[model samples]
Target chain A: MLYLDLTLQGLIQGSMYALIAVGLTLVYGLLRILHVAHAGLFTLGAYIAVTVTNAAGSLLLAALVAVPLVGLAGMAIYRLLYEPILHRPPFVALIASIGLFICMEEGFRLVFGPYGNSFDLSPVEGSVQLGALSLQTVEAATIVAAFGLLGALAVFAGRTRIGVAWRATVTDPEMAQSFGIDTVKVRYLNFFIGSALAAVAGVLVALLNNFVEPTMGSVPSYKMLAIIVLGGLGNVKGTLVASLALGVMESFGTIYAGHIMDRDAIAFLFLVAVLMVRPQGLFGKA
Target chain B: MGAYELSLLTLIGINVLLALSLNLITGFCGQISLGHAAFYGVGAYTAAMLTKAGIGFAPALVAGAAGAALLGLIVGIASLRVRADFLAITTMGVGFLFLGVVRQQEWLGGELGISQISESGLGETGFLLLVLGLAAGVFAISLYIKRSWMGFAFDSIADDEDTARTVGIDVARYKLVAFALGTAIAGVAGGLYAHYARIIVPDAFGFTVSISILAMVVVGGIGSTVGVLIAAVLLTLMPELFRFINDYKLLLYGGLLLLTMRFSPAGLAGLARLGWTAGRKAERRPA
Candidate 1:
């Protein structure tokens, strides 16, 4: 029963990881850029959602406000920062993304204070009793929302015209543009959807923890890098699978090795091991 | 000079070394390290532990460099098998792992850090001179490498690994050497920092420090030794002169980085050369 509970909890945690890592992977797939500032969107989503919830006393309203706000901000970042520097070396874009992330983090510290904020009313306090097991409302909601949204993403990318166009752009932007694909709009849409997904993940994790802090994105920033690499960089399904697998492994590993090494250490060891054994990534082409 | 001035000058020297070390990795080898502070931290901690346990300063510093180099070589061998960018992400992971281990362990002094560290027998002036000498030595070595056959191999690898490999360069071996040499220098700087500050904390060697060092290299112009030195000195002095800049240093540097990457990917050195060429063109065209 305890193992089942842990597994269930790990799945919930995995869903959240999927939510964040998917956004990161999407950006990397489109542009070779690491999109390090994607972590900023995660932090922003949490802060805005919690702040809105605290003020309006409505979780629905918080989600409504947070998701689109950060989504547009992500689009703006693409247009303002990344668009002009696209011609430079790949490292230029990378360093710029990192710089932007630093700015966002420090800005959050200055504006939001160094300390963290807590939800005045959280729906995640109690646990639901399932047959011989228990699950928190936050956990069930997280799994449902994350997987359901991911499913929608899969369908959108696989079935819809815009989805096909986005994938086409990812593969060969010049050819897609020559075919009159309106690649710029596709890029904006890609960023909007990706950033919205990150916002959703941020809010869900904030609900689960009942706290939103400035530096909350730091660990996830690098941890998701490990996920993207493990799933094989620029692969969405791989990221999702990798995130869930790592989540389960971490949950179980924590019980046994919590005193020895932390979760980040475990994840990085996985990254190093993967790099050693399969540098092309676990799912990447040989 | 007053004691404060002397200490600041000494720090400038140490930071110059750190920046140069990163310049070798990111600027020359084109293997970006977002976690360089990991090597520096390892060096610092090893030197701190050894000197605290009655080892001499010189020996402890050497031990620190050796420790960083060994770990760096290992990291290189593991990550350099794939794309160059893999090294970047791997190094970052290493940095976080280093911090996580330090923060959790009771033996490593955890968060509060180790204080009242034993100082080198060198007087303040003597220590400053030693640091300056080391910086000059590294600087000289950097110039020599710029003119060597191995340097040509590194430049080729930096430009395009596939092309370099096709041209018969041992890309992997050269990368390992760069990692080993760059990290060894970082270790020496870390040891010097530990003894100079007379205390060491885990946070002192976190991501921010790595970013600052990268900023020095990039803003100084990547792969430009003299430009990096000038940028390092200017950046190190900026915060000290304007007291408020200390609090906002990361924000300002972050902004500077964005601007630098956008306006001049070649950094200060490139901009200077551009201006020089422009001036020469204008002079030649005059009536």
Candidate 2:
């Protein structure tokens, strides 16, 4: 029963990881640049959601407002900060992203204060029990929402013209451009969708943890770096699989080796192990 | 100089060492490490613990550097297969792991950290001179390396590893050497920082510090020792100079980084070079 409970909890957390990791992977696929500032976008989404939820008294309204705002912020960041350096070495964009990350994190600190904000939404008052296992309402919501978002994304990417354009751009931007597709617009759309996914994960995380802090996104962002690498860089399906695996490993690691190995250390050690053992990742194609 | 000014100068010296160290790896070797602070922390803790155990300062510093170099070798080897963004993330993870270990281990002083690190007995003036002398020594070494065959190998690897390898340059060995040398310097800086501050906390060497050091290198002009030195001094003092806008200092720093990368990818040194060349061209035209 305890094991089953842990599995359920792991899946819930893993779902959030999948959402965040997929966003990172998508951006990496579209642009060779790793958006370190994506974490800032995640934090912004959470803070904005918190502010909106507190003011308007509706979680749905908060998501509707904050997600788009964060998405626009992502697009704006690309245009203002990234577009000029797109042709430069990847490191230049990376350093710029790091700088943007610092600005956004510090900005959040100055605006929201350096403390955690309680997620003002009331808790869903019940839990569902199945056989010997029980799941909290928020956990269920997180799992459902994560899968729903990912499924919607998979379908959109598979069925739609924009999705085909996106995949084409990912495959080869110059080739896609030669095909009359606006690679630049595709990149912007990619950023928007990725940022939106991160925003949803951010809000879901706040709901699960019941608090949002300025630095809340930092650790997860680093962990998601590990996840993306574990899933073989820009592989979407691999990212989802790696996220769940990491979630489960973390759950069990916290249970058994929590005293010896710090929970954070476990994730990193797993990352190192993966890098050492299978540099291409488990599900990644060579 | 006043105590405040002397301490600030000492800090700049330490930061210069750190920036130069990172410049060696990232700027010169073309390997990005987001965990440079982990080496710094390792050096600090090693020196602090050894000195706390009554070891001599010289030996403690060496141990700190050696310890960091060892960790650097391990990380370098582990991340050998990865490149660019993958390498950056790997090093970043290593940094987090270092902090996590420090926070969890009571022997390393855990969250409370180690304090009352016995002074170097060199006081502020003497310590400043010591740090300055060491910084100059490291600067000379960097210049030598920059002009040597090793520099050529690093440059080739940075430009294109496969090509370098095809040309018979042992990319792996040189990369490990760069990692070891850079991390060793970072460890020395950390040791100096620990002794000077008389207290060491794991939090002091987190990702922010790593980013700050990287910022110093990039803003200074990657691979230029003198540029790194000047940039280090400028960034370290900028916060103090602009105390009125203290809250927005990081934001300003970030903005400066973005602007610098966009306009002058080579940093201040690059800008200076460009101006020099343009002035020469104008003078020749007039002639």
Candidate 3:
């Protein structure tokens, strides 16, 4: 029964990780730079959602408004900060992203105050039983919403014209440009989609935990970095698999190792081990 | 000078050492380590623990450097197969791992951290002098390395590892050496900081400190020892001078970093070189 409970919990967490990791992987695929500020955007999305929910008194409406707003903010950040240095060394863009992260994080603290705000979505108020196991309404909703979003994204990327253009830009921007694809527009679209995905993950996380704070994104962002690496950088399928594996391992490892093997340490150990054995990542192509 | 002013000078010296150490790796060797503060923390904890165990201050400092260098060597070896972005993320993971370990261990004082450390019996002036002396020694060593054959190998590796390898330079060994050297100095700086502050917390050595050190190296001009030194001093003192707008300090830092990278990627040193050449051209034309 305990094992069953843990597995279900892990699956829920894994779905959230998958959402965040996939968004990060997409951005990396297109830009070849780690979007460190994506974490700040995650926090921003949650805060925005909470504010909107408080003002309007509807979780669905708050998410609907916040996701697109954060997505636009992501595009604006790319234009203002990253576009100019796109030609520079990758690290330059990374540093700029770090700077952006600091600005956003501190800005949120100044505006929203340092205290954690209750998400107050008041999600379904109770738990449900299934045979020998039980699950919260929020958890079930998160898993369903995560899969729904992922499924939608997979279809969009695999079938839609703009999505095909995004994949082409990722695979070979120069060739795609020669083929008359507006590489710049595709890049902007990529940022919007990726940021929207992150915002969705952020909203789900806030809803699950029932709280949001400026610093909430820091650890999760780093964990997402580990997930993307473990799943293989820029590999969406790999990210999903890796996120689930990581979530399960973390759940089991923490239980077995008592107090020492914390979630961050387990993720870090997995990262180091994977990096040492297969630097290209488990699913990454050489 | 007053004790307060001397303490500030001591801080500048410590930051200068940190910037110089990061400059050695990121600027000279072209390795982007986002976990430099992990080494800094290692040095601090090692020194603090050793001194608490009845070891002499000097010996504890040396032990701290050795400990940090050992960890750096391990990380460097692990990072050999990885490239730029992977290396950055790996080092970041290592940094977080260090914090996690320190936070969980009760012997390391856990979250409260090791405090009430015994002083080095050296007054503020003595500590300042020691820091200045060490800073000077590091600068001199850095200058020597810049002019030596080792510098050529490092430059080659930084410019193009494949070409450097083809040229018979041992890239891996050189990179490991660079990591050891950089981290050893960071360790030294950490030891000094622990003794000076008499309190060491894992929080002090988080990602923000690493970024601040990286900022110093970048703003000073990577590979320019003098430039890094000056920038370190400026950045450390600038916050104290602008106490009124303390809340927005990090925001300002972020803005400065963005502007500097966008406008002058080579940093202050590159700008100074441009000015020097332009002045010379004007002088020659007038003559």
Candidate 4:
């Protein structure tokens, strides 16, 4: 029963990881750069969602506005900073992203204060009992929402023209350009979609935890990077699998290792080991 | 030196060293380290503890460098297999874990940090002069390395590691050397910092410091030693010069980083490069 409970908890957590990782992997798959501040956007999404929900009195409606707002912010960032410098060296882009991260962190700190903010979003009100088991309402909803989002993403990426353009850009940006694909447009669209997904994940997370903080999003960013490496860069299914596997290992590892192995360290060690033994990752194409 | 001038000078000297050290890894070797403050912290803590245990400042400084270099060597070994961005993420993880260790350990003084560190025999003004001297020494050494075979190896590795590897250069070995050398410098800087500040805390060496170092390199120009020095000097002086904006130091720091990179992608080094090229051309045509 304990094992069952842990597995359930791990799966729920893994779902959230998948949502965040998928957004990050989407951008990396296309740009081949680590947008370090994308995590800041994720942080923004949570704050905006919480603030909106408090003002508007509806979690769903708050998320609806927050996602697009975050998406537009991503678009504005790319247009104002990334596009002109896209021709520059990759490091410059990275530095810019890091700068963006700092700006967001400071801005949020100024507005929200260093201490965290909590929101009342858990519809569960408590926990549900089953045959020799129990599960929180919020946790169950997170898993369901994660699967729904992933399914929708799979369909969108597979069947849509915009998705096809993004896929082509990821495969080869220059060649896609030669083939009449507007790489910049694709980037804008992808950033929008990716930022929206991250925002939605932030919203889902707020529901699960019932609180938000300025610094809460940073650890998850590192964890998502680890998942991307372990799953194989550019492989979406790989990210999902890796996140779930890591979630299980971490859940069990915490139980046995007695906090000696933190979730971040465990994920990081997995990434290091993978990069060492198989730089291509488990499912990443060589 | 007056108080304000002395303080600015000290800060510039320290930051210049820190930025230059980071340049060896990020600028020359093309490895991005988002968590360099860990190395800085390691050096500071090791030096402080040793000095507190009755060791003299000079030996403690050496010990700090050696300890930081050893840690860097270990990290290099653990990290060399990964590619660029992945390596950045991994280092960040190590950094967070290091902060956690520093935070939790009681004997290391926990969060309150070690205080009452005895100053070097030099008085405050004399210490500032000494720090400036050390800064000049470091600049000379960094420039020499930038012009030598080792610098060539690092540049080639940065340009294309695979090509360098094919040309019989040991990419991993050179990277380890850069890591060790850069971290050793950071360690020495940390020692100087502890003695000057008269207090050492883990919180002092966090992501913000790392970001500042990265900013210095980015604003300075990665592969250009002079650019990094100028950047370090300007950035350090800015906060002290405009005390009103101290709370927004990070905001302005981020803004400056973005503006510099966008406007001068090659950084201050770009101007240096142009001057050198023009001088060479003039010499060839007239003489």
Candidate 5:
């Protein structure tokens, strides 16, 4: 039962990881840029959610407000920060992303006063029970939200014309452009969707913790890098699988090795260990 | 010089060493390591422990460099398999792991960190002079490498790894050498830093420091050693130039890095070339 409880907890946590990593995978597929500031967007989403919820006194209203803004911010980052250097070594794009992330972190500290914010109006303390399993209202909502949105993403990618155009762009940008696929719009769409997912994850994390801080996105930002690698770079399905797997590993690691190292240390150990093993197909570049 | 001014100069000297160290790897070797601070921290802790154990400052700095070189070799082994973006993230993970270990271990002083880190006993001006001397030595060494055969190998590898390999250049060995040498220099800087302040904390070696050093290398013009040195000196002294800059250090560093990379990918070196070309064209024109 304890094991089951941990697995459940891990899955709920993994849903958020999946949300963030999926966004990262999308951007990497499209531009190979790594989109590091996506973490900043996650932090931004949490800040916006908390600020709006506090002012308006509603959670749904907060999500509605935060998601689109984050998505648009994502497009802006790509256009303003990445577009110029896209032709240079991929490392240049990465460095710029890091700078943007650093700027955003400090900007948050300056504007938000560096401490943290909590939900003033707490949601109902409800629990969901399912056949010898139980979950908090926050956990249940997070899981349901992840599934609903990721499922919608899958359907959109598989069925829609823009979605096909996106896949084409990812496979080969120049070829897709030659085919009149409008790869630039596809790039913006990629950022929009990916950043929106990150925003969703950020809001869920804020709700789960009931607090948001400037450095909230720091750990997850790097962990998603590990996930992208573990999923094999640019491989969506692999990323999804890796996210859940990492969440479970982290849950167990925190329980077992928590005394030996911090949660982050344990998680990064998994990254090192994964890189060392280099299991053939699982981590093969997409 | 006054004590305050001497200390500030010494601090800038250490930062120059760090930027030069990063320049060797990221600039010369074309390897991206987002977690270079781990090596810096390793050097700091190693020197601090040894100096506190009654070892001479010189030997402790040597030991610190050696310890960091060993860790670099280990990380470089990982880099043997991965390249480009994957390599960057892997190095970053290593950086995070270092911070976590330091924070958790009681002997590392955990969160409070180590204080009263034994000094080098070289008085104010003397210590500053020693640091400046070491910085100059590293600069000379960098210049030598830039003109040496190894530089060619590194350039080839950086330009294209598979092509370098096809040309019978040993990519793996050069990459490891860059990693080892670069990290050893960073370790030396870290050791100098520990004694300069006579206090050591994990926060001082966080991701921000790594990025700041990187900013120096990028903004200075990647492979251009002189530009990097100048940028390091300037960036170190920036907070002193503007009081508000101290509060927004990362923002300033991040902003400089972003704008520099976006506008001029080759950084100051690229800009200088542009100006030089324009001047030459004007001279050759019907003016």
Candidate 6:
């Protein structure tokens, strides 16, 4: 029963990881570049959501506003900084992303100060009775929200022309462009979608943690990277499975863990160990 | 040497070693390591704790380099196959895990870090000059590496890992060596820093320092040794130029990065090329 409870909690938390991982995986798959600033963008979303929710007293509305705003911010960043360096060496993009990450974080620090903000997003207060073990209402809601968003994403990708175009762009951008697909448009859409997903994850994390700090997204973002790699880089189902397993392992590891062996270090050790043993991750096709 | 001046030069020398070490890894090798600072922290914390436990500074420096090298070796083995963009993220994990260890482990001094690190042999000024001279030697070594066959191998690996492997190069071996050596240099920097600063703080060697070092490489130029040296000197001195912005120092630093990325991808090195090339072109095809 304890194991089950831990598993449930981990899976719920893992859902947030899955969302962020998917966005990251999509960006990497499409651009063949890692967006280091994605974490900063994630933190930015949480800050914006927290302020909006506190002022307007509407978490739902705040999500609506903050998500798109982050997406637009993502687009603007690409337009302003990345597009010019698109054809340069891979490190150019990496450096630019690092610059963007610093800009976002330092900009936030300048505005919000370096201290962690105790954000009061009204969390779901009730608990769901699940046979022998009871789960918090927020946890149940988290699972539903995660699966629902993922399901919606899958449906959108499968049933829509835009999604098909995105898939084509990922496979071969040059070929897709030659065939009359607007590669720029697809890239823009991917940026927006990826950024918005990161934003949603950020807001959810703030609610779960009950605190929002300038560096809040750093650790979680790293964990999500592990998840994406553990799952196949571009495989959605693989990412979902990997995230759930990682979440449970991490949670149990934390609760029963020794002082010297932190949950994070152990998790990363597992990641590094696994990667060493299996260079391509468990679910990775590559 | 004046106390303040000596301290500033010592810090500058240490930072030069760090930024140059990272240039070897990121600039020369074409890998972006977000956790480069972790190696520095590992070195500092290791040296401080070891010396506090009665080991001399020289031995402590070796231990620091060895410890950081071991950590880098492990991280390199795990993620060298990934390379570049993915490597950045994984190295970040490795870096954070290093910090997590420092924060959680009791032996590492946890949050307080290791204080009262012994300053044996040379006093403050002697130590400063010794370290700075040692750093100059390392800089000379970097220049040698930059012009050698091994340097070409590193550059080849950086340019295209798979291609380098196909051309009979042991990509992993080169990368591991570069990673280990880069980290060892960081360790040396940490050792010097611990002695001079007289206190080892975990926060000082966090991601921010990693970014600053990378900025030194980027806002300077990727492969230009002199550019890196100039950039490091200028950035270290830039804060001294403005007193009012000290409170928002990091914020201004961030803005500097944004401006550098947008306007000058090649950094100060790029500016010189811009003028030189434009002048040459004018000479050839003037109306």
User: In lDDT terms, which candidate is top?
Assistant: 5
- DockQ of every candidate structure: 0.60, 0.63, 0.64, 0.45, 0.73, 0.46
For candidate 5, the docking band is medium
Which pairs clash (backbone N, Cα, C closer than 3 Å) in model 6?
none
Window of ten residues with lowest summed lDDT in model 3 chain B? B244-253
- Model 4 Cα lDDT, one tens digit per residue, A10-106: 8888888888888778777877766777788888898988888887787778888999999998788778887788777676787787788778888
The digit string of per-residue lDDT tens for model 1 on B235-258 reads: 999989999998989888888788
lDDT string for model 3 (B1-287, tens) is: 98779999999999999999988888888888888999999999999999988899999999999999999999889768897889988998888888887888889998889998878778789999999999989989888888899888889988888999999999999999999999999999999999999999888998888878888888899889999999999988888888966667777677667677777878999999999999999989955
Name the runs in model 6 displaced over 4 angstroms.
A116-124, B75-80, B162-173, B280-287
Candidate 1 lDDT tens digits, A20-128 = 8998888888877788889899999999999999999988999999999999999999999999988877778888888898889889889889898989977457777
Error of 4 at A176 (Å): 4.8
Q: Write the per-residue lDDT of candidate 2 for residues A156-241, one digit (tens) a residue.
A: 99999999999999999889999999998998898899999899988887777778998898888789888888888789999999
Better TM-score candidate (2, 4): 2
Of models 1 and 3, which has the larger DockQ?
Answer: 3
**What is the alpha-carbon lDDT of model 5 when measured against the actual structure?**
0.89
**lDDT comparing candidate 1 with the true structure:** 0.88
Model 4 clash pairs?
none
Q: List model 2 lDDT by residue over B1-287, tens digit each.
A: 78889998999899989999999999889898989999999999999999999999999999999999999999889657878887888898899889877888879888889999998877789989999999999899999999999999999998999999999999999999999999999999999999999999878999888888988999999888888889998998888888976667777778777778877889989988999999999989955
In Å, residue B272's CA in model 6 sits off its true spot by 2.2
Model 4 over residues B1-287: C-alpha lDDT tens digits? 57878777887888888998999888878887877888888989999999899999899999999988988887787567676776787677667666766765677887788999887778879889878888898889888988999989999988988999999999989999999999999998888898888898887887778889988888888878889999898888787788977888998888777777777877778867878999999989954
Candidate 5 structure quality by residue, lDDT tens digits, A132-237: 8978888999889988999999899989998898898899989999999998999899999999999999999998999999989988888898888888878888
Determine which window of 10 residues in candidate 1 chain B has minimal summed lDDT: B78-87
Greater lDDT among 4 and 5 belongs to 5
Say which prediction, candidate 4 or candidate 6, comes out ahead on TM-score. 6
Off by over 4 Å in 4: A113-116, A120-126, A159-165, A173-184, A252-263, B2-8, B271-287
Best by DockQ, which number? 5
